[model samples]
Target chain A: MYQLTTVTKRYQRGKQTINALEGVDLTIATGDQLVVQGPTGGGKSTLLQMLGALDRPTAGSVSIDGTDLARLSEAKLTKVRAATIGFVFQSFNLIPTLSAQENVETALVPLGVKPAARRKRAAEALQLVGLGDRLRHLPSELSGGQQQRVAIARALVKEPKVLLADEPTGNLDEDTRDEIMGLLAGLWKDRGLTFVLVTHDSSIARRAPRLAVINNGRLKVTERTP
Target chain B: MFFTYLRRELRRRRKAALVVALGLALGIGLVITVSSVSTGMRDAQDEVLHSLYGVGTDLTVAKEAKAEEGGSAPQRFKIEGREDGEKASETDDRLMPLGGFDNLDDSVVDKVAAQDGVATAVGALALNDIKFTGDFKPGEMKKEEGKPGSGGGPRVGGGGADIETETFTVMGVDVSALSVGPLSSSKISKGANFAATDTEALKAVVDSAYAKDKDLAVGDKVTIKGKKFEVAGIATADTGASTSNVYIPLAQAQKLADADMKGKVSKVYVKADSSDAIPAVKKAISENVDGATVTSAADLAEQVSGNLSTASNLATNIGKWLSIAVLVAAFLLAGLLTMSAVSRRVREFGTLKAVGWRSGRVVRQVMGEAFANGVLGGALGIGLGLAGAWIVSTVAPTLTATTGGEQPGGPGQGGGPGGGGIAQQLGEGAQQSVDIALKAPVTLSVIVLAVVLAAAGGIIAGCFGGWRAARLRPADALRRVE
Candidate 1:
């Protein structure tokens, strides 16, 4: 479970200051998939960064599974981020030199996975995303859909509690976008893990059981499926 | 994990890393070149000193004769078993410190030879002021200018050399020790040595340099002091300041220089069987020969021979400073290169920090990369040093006391390939060859030192790079998003 109370994030560029996020209260239950829809510069990415422990809020308290993120040391916060969260970026962010399998294995590296087991686990993770045959392919060698699948495999390899994806399928075609959406829905349903995705597409938001729209650094819920 | 990152990183940025490695190599190469030359010079100095001191000659015995009151009337004698009336023999020759002009009795050689610990005693007339037959005048010849390594160490045969004024260090020895005594180290480059048994042939064994200058060879007859001598052989010796250019029988040198000096040797050099017998033999010689001064090789190197001492000092001190300067430059060059690399890889390092890698681990990864550069740089430095040393040595060998000491009535004075000046008035001089051997002083110790220094330079650079990487904030780094 994730809880945020009166969260405010500010960005200062030289003399002028911009409020990226302000006065936001949000709660995410365990095993819940929430689709957050927002216009450009509405601070959805900032909210996700705060929730994932990648950034600290200027004001307010953020607690994940009962521990306050603001009170944790940098080292402890790093451990929390690695252990409890998975991140999927819209751009894929795969290291060009590494193959699809190595990209997945990178997540397990910090977990101190042994080489033989790490390789086997990485292959299995790729196979879970229907990319077993593309295990040895570099990111550049894969299609946009296949590349996003490799990114998803990397995020899911460690089996984290929360998956924070910022426009995960925003760069894909409509057909490939639907394919990635199906994969994420399948993983969340099968593993019973919480998935929070930020997107501008209303079609992406309509597919989620819970949905919210962020505007001017404020959040307003559209609906929550009973 | 650090190793894996290091290997891949280095391969990816090999061009940049090679720039840093090559910079370090020049510094190490310079150190090697300077050290080898310095080391080579030191060895040559030792050789020259050893030769002048003579082989197996533990003690050199010479009769010291002079008056305390500045007059010849009063003399001091320290002979152990001596009569009360006997006075010291004094000579007017100030340049010859070995008392070559003082006609000591022939019985002194016998007395020294008969000592208990004395292995063999050879008496010689060390006449340094003897003139040769070629020079036209005294003041006409100055040092030849613009020659490589022309001036250094002590000048051979003292400082007052006039190339036009024919002069030679005439060391008339007992012919037996010519090949067995001090001259034994003299390698004969072209011809053989004069027969040790041949007593009186008035034959000369010339220095190879002198032979070349004079166009002299075996069976060639040359006249000095109205008497002609056949050139017997050409040989080389390692005599630095005391290098003798002419060697003849003791009897002949005595006859040519002074008819009244027969059966009188200026110095008797005694060789002990071993180092242990040196003190005993010295004691015996001191007791038997009155007013004799005995010197060993170590004493000759330290107390005497200014040229040898100067050469040794230059070799040891100069080389050390040169190596240090190069090492400092190597460190700075490598540091600058690695630091630049750190700045360029800002995003990469930041990403590493963001991905659950600790600050220490990131620093270690950077340091490992620097260490790899050290390995490559060290190998290149060693190879470059060796090759550079060889080239420098081949082109122009460094001057030692022996090779540069002789300025002469030089080996280039007469003959000039076709022969010019006729043989002049009667004088005594030796024609022993001048042999100088130059080699690169690249020892195992020097190689190890070069490698260690190069590696240390890399480590220092790595530390700086690590420090810079460690200071990077992961959040700020991740903001770059590259």
Candidate 2:
């Protein structure tokens, strides 16, 4: 579980301070599937970064499983991030040089997993994402949908407590988006995992158990449609 | 864990690794080759000096002009200045009352013989411009016989061309008398026991030359300046002081040069009881026999050793500069490879950071990759360097000369002749080359230096690449499409 209390992130640009996140508050619980929806530059990515502990809040506290993000050392935070959070990006973010299986195996590196068992687990994760036969292919050789699936598989390979996906379906076609969404939901349901997804699609937002709309560095809760 | 990272890095950058390895190999190879040849040259010089000079003489005392009543002492002697006041002054000094040269009388010799640590003291005399005539002819003299306005025709067969010869003072010892130090043995082209003190052996050589030419026989006459003496015996001298000299009995030589005036001899050659006694003998001779110069085989050896030290230092410096050049080239090649790898993997590094890998880990991976390539490259380079050294030593002009192969006369020659005579050609080819090879050992040190240099170059290049990769921000890195 994680909570953001009145978070405000500011960037100094010459003589002005740009507010990326302002007075934002949110809470995420175990097994909760929440989607944060906003247009480009609407602070959707910044909010996700704060929730995942990738970026610290500038004005407020972000506590993940009761540990404050602002107080943790960089090394300790890296450990926390590795063990408790997994990331999926719109561009897939799979290492272009590594095979689909190796991209997944990279997530297991910080866990001190042995190479053989890491490969086995990576294969299983890829199979779960319906990419069992594309394990040896590079990201460059894969389509946008398949590459995103590999990214999702890499995110799940480490079995982190929380999965943070920023625009997971932004690069996919409508049919591919539906398929990827189904796979994400299936993983959440089967493993009882917490997922904080950032998307611009209202249709994708309606499928989540909860929806939070962020506008101008501020977040407001909307009714759960599903 | 490190090896796994290293392995992956190598696999990912095989082409770059290959290029670095090849570059290192060429660099190391050149280093080894040059070092080996230089060392070989130094060693050859040492061998020739030992054979020619037998460690050399320790000291040479000659008349100093200051010892004379009213002449300034000259710093050095000049062969063409006998008529100069400097020569007259030096001769006067030898005859001065208080000078050490005057103290070399017979009483002085007896006193030095009685002194502690004194060894056998045989008198010696030295003269230049002596002429010898015989069935055997000397090499053609290059000096001009007469001035243009002298109006004298070149002297013909009776006088023959005046050949300058160096004559040594010889001691009248029996054939069994053992010469000590470097003079114990002689290197002669033909005829054995030519150094014998036995009158019969000496007479035999003299008689044989006389049979072919009347002027060369025992009792036959040869002239030194205007003084003529009956030929007594023919003898060969020791390698140390024999190359340009002929010797006769000490008493005879002194008598011929009028050097026994005041019952004194020109110089004395002292033979130590053993090698260890040489220093003590030299010291006693110096202290007791004031006007005479005392020399030891060991002192000569030290001079040779000093020369060897200088040569080795020069060689080592040359090798270091060459190795530095090689290392720089290797570093440049390695840097280029690293940069290329980094450029290609910008996105990969970003993805790793985004996946929560620390900057340190990414840097470690990059360095690990570089280290792996470096080690492999260094090893291959060392092997190539050794091979190159061998090839160079075998094919190099100086080495080929030392090995007794004939000099390759021109570019068109397929190969040159081979044998010991060829070594003589090498001697004439380059004086410094022979000196360098004669004194130094070439193989082991050169190889070790080359390998170490290559590895160090690699590590430096790797660190540069690692620093660049570690500074990249994940957000910005990910934003790049490629």
Candidate 3:
């Protein structure tokens, strides 16, 4: 479960103050899949950054599983990001120099996992994402869809409590996008994990059980889908 | 775990890593080569100095402008200088009544020998008035002539005039005390050395090189000041060092120079009990003898060798500083290269931090790569230094010179007037050593220092790059690249 109480985030760009998220308030219960829909520069990614403990709010608090993210130190925040949240970017940020399995193993390095166990867990994660035979394939050697699958495998390798995807299907073809959406929905239902997807596309937002639209730096609840 | 990531990065960017390593290596090589060459030159100069003043003779005592020989009343010879006057003029107060030029009394030698640190003291008279006579080829004497007045060598004839007799440098030593001094048995090359029991007969020993060139063997008779002397033996010395062609008894040399310096020695070879005691002995000799120009062998060595001390100083000071500047530049170059590399990979590091990597871990990764590069550079530098030394030694040029200590055929030397052979023979002191090869042997300490420097350069470069990496915010890094 996560909760945000009027969280605000601001940045300084050459003497100008830009409000990334202005006193935004939101909350999601356990096992909730909230899809945040927004136009370009709508602060949806900023909101996701706060929820995932990647950035601290200028004001207000973000509570995930009853622990306030804004009050946590940088060290504790990193720990929370490691154990509680997983991120998937639209660019499929898989290290190009590493193999698919090695990319997944990166998530386990900071956790002090032994190499043997880390490799075993990484392989299983890749297999779960239908990249079982692509263990040794580099990002450049794989298709865009396959690279996205590898990125997803890397995020899920740690078995985090929440999954944060920022336009995960924005770079994929329609057929590959449908497959990825179905896969994410199936994982959400089977594992009862909180899924927060940030996207500007209404087609992608329809797949979520709950939808929220963001304009400027403010958020509003749109609809609840069954 | 950091090593795992770093290893991959290095493998992926091998060309860049090699560049950084080579830059550091070049700096290290230059440092080692310059230091070693300078150090080697210093050592070689010391070796030459050790031979010049006689191996164990730590101090030498002489009278200024004093080795004057009497023609009839024994007071005609004296070097022309501010301290010396015409010994022939009895009214001149500057000229000592007796033993004017380089001639110090036996009593002064005894006093120096009795000093606290005095091990053994012997006396020798430098006489450059003598010449070797044998069947000679015409023009050979002119070709084998030594230059005069180099490194304060004996003053030959005032001007130029070839004498019928080709003159040679000569030394008169106390026969009984020669055993305990620098002219020990080791200096004898053939026949036998002058023994302690050898009386003051007409006996003499010729330097081996002079003996060979003159075809004069042991037991051959030679004439000095018209007095015949039996050649007792042959001796050899280092090429650049000053050694008279003939070594005669102290009494005979005194008689040859004349009555003015009679019963006195030209140079008192004092052997100190220890090297550290030379200074104390010098101080003691100065206090004991009046008007004596007492000089330590070290000072004499410096005075005798041309441009050696200056060259050593320039290399150690100027060359060392230049090498240090190069090393710093090498460090900065490596830093810049690594910084450029890190800038290009900012996104990779940003992703790593977003996952779970701490800032310290990333820093360690950078430093580790730098350290590796540094170690590789050190290895390359050492190899380069060795190769450079080899090339220098192999391509060195040979030089011929002489060590001229005394010239006797001057205005009043043994009453030889207008005889210019002294000027012709004075070039003997300019070491005839053709072996001018520079030995730049790399020492262990220098090697260790160079290796350490290489590693330090790499680590310093890594620190610069790591600082930039640590400042990178994960949010901004993620947004920079696709």
Candidate 4:
């Protein structure tokens, strides 16, 4: 479970204040699929980052599993990120030097898994993403769509309670985007994963069980299309 | 976990790691080379001083008159006063001047000889003059015909009427009583046996007469200042005393030099049976033998050893300073390179931070990379420095003229012939060669330290860099086009 109370993130740009997110309050429970949809510069990514514990809100409290994120020490927050949250970046930010399997294994490093078992778990995660044959391939060698799938595999490898994806299919073609979305939806349903996705495309945003529209620095919640 | 991080860091920044290693290698190599050279110089000095001085000498009875005048030639003084005066008068009053003495009374020799730890008591005589012989001159006919001989004649290029010879000192030692062995024999016209005869026989030989320039050899007929005798044998002294001296029986030397007397010996050599006896023996000699100054081999050795040690210390200090300079330069260069590399990796680090990696881990990874580079570079530098030292040593000229050889240049001209110049040059060359050898040993330790420092430095730098990187809001980092 995640909750945000009157969170506001502000930045200073050469003597002027820029409000990236202002007075936003939101919550999501287990198995809930929440999508924050907005145009570029509408604070969708900032909201997702705050929810994922990757960034601290400038002026409010973010609580995950009832632990105030702002109050947690840096090390404790890192542990929280490692144990309870997973992130999927739009660019599929897998290390180019690592093979697809190794990219998945990177998440296990913080878990203190022995190398062999880590590798074993990584390979299994890749298999779940239907990239079993491509485990040894580097991210550069994979197609854009396939790299995103590896990213998804990495996100799921830790089996975190919350899966946060930022424009998961932003770089893919229409057909590949749909395919990735289907794989994500199936995993989310089967594993009862809590999903919080940031996207600009209304079509993709509509697939979520719930949607929140962000305009300026405020959020407007709306029901799912179905 | 540390090793794994190190491995990954090394793999990721292989080039930077290499640079650090090279810097370290250079520093270590230099240290080893310098130390070796310093050690070698010490050993050479020790050998020469030890061989010449022996364990210790009891009484150096230089003539008080000559000591006052500061003449360079060797002199002697007589021991006098009550037998207890030998023990009681610690002052210089007991010394009596005795110059050019060849033999002391047998009773005097026996008296000192009876003292505890007195190994052997022998008299010595020293004389310096030009040596001339037939080999240095031409035959009568050749002299008339104008052919130059091996003889360095005074006349221009003819077995000249007279020959000019270099001034040489003949030091007569009691070969029969010598405790130390000969170092070389080419310069000794007669074998050492010539000096091994009894006192009377030696006296008879020295008292016989012969021609001034007669050629002599083992078994050949010869004479000392007109006293005739058959040559017995020849021998050489140690390098320290090699410049002067032909060894002969003490009686023979006294007879030849016309220096036999009742209460005189050139100097009394006293050996303590063990090191502990030195002080006591010296005390006895000082008390019993007036006008004699006692000295120990340890003191002489220390004097020589000190000179070498000072030189070595200077060299090592110079080397250390040089290494420090190099390390500082290396650190700066490495720091600049690391900073640049980190600048380029800002995005990557930010991604890692975003992916749950801690700032400390990022710093460690960077430092590990630096350490790897340092180790590799240091090994290489060490190899290069040793090779350089070896090559320099091989090509460099000798610093000193070895004993028994003519130094190639004039005295004080480092390039001079048969003088201190050669030894000095050789020493300098050795110093330089060792400087090269030192590169590796010095470089290795330096490199190891440097690399470790560099890694730590890199980590600190990277920590600051990583902290800055981690402070960035992820959305801004991801949104930046560059």
Best by DockQ: 3
Q: Which ten-residue region of model 4 chain B has the weakest summed lDDT?
A: B428-437
TM-score attained by model 2: 0.63
True contacts kept of each: 0.17, 0.33, 0.38, 0.23
Off by over 4 Å in 4: A13-16, B1-20, B23-167, B170-322, B400-482
lDDT of 3 by residue, B1-482 (tens): 56666777788888888888888888898888888878667656655544545666677777766333663353343222322322221111111211225467878888878988999888776666533222222221123236564454433333222223354656677888775433542277788877766657888887776777778898898777777888888877553333456778877777677346677776777788998888888898888778877777556544543345555666789878988888888899889988888898787887778787777877788888887888887888888877776675676423222233443333234222212212211222222231234567788999999889988987998898899888887777875743
| Better structure of 3 and 4 per TM-score | 3
Cα lDDT tens digits, model 1, B399-449, are 434221222333322222211110000011112222345556788888998
Q: Which of candidates 1 and 2 reaches a greater TM-score?
A: 1
Q: How do the candidates score on chain B by TM-score?
A: 0.58, 0.49, 0.69, 0.48
Query: Which DockQ value does candidate 3 get?
Result: 0.50
Chain A: TM-score in each model = 0.97, 0.96, 0.97, 0.97
Say what the RMSD of model 4 is: 12.6
Q: Docking category for candidate 2?
A: acceptable
**Cα displacement (Å) at residue B318, model 3:** 4.3
- How many residue pairs clash per model? 13, 19, 27, 66
User: CAPRI band of model 4?
Assistant: acceptable
- Over the stretch B244-346, how does candidate 4's per-residue lDDT look in tens digits? 2233455555555533433444544544566677677767866886555555544544434333445545556876577667656665565566666666666
Top lDDT model: 3
Candidate 4: lDDT over CA atoms? 0.57
Ranking of predictions according to DockQ:
3, 4, 2, 1
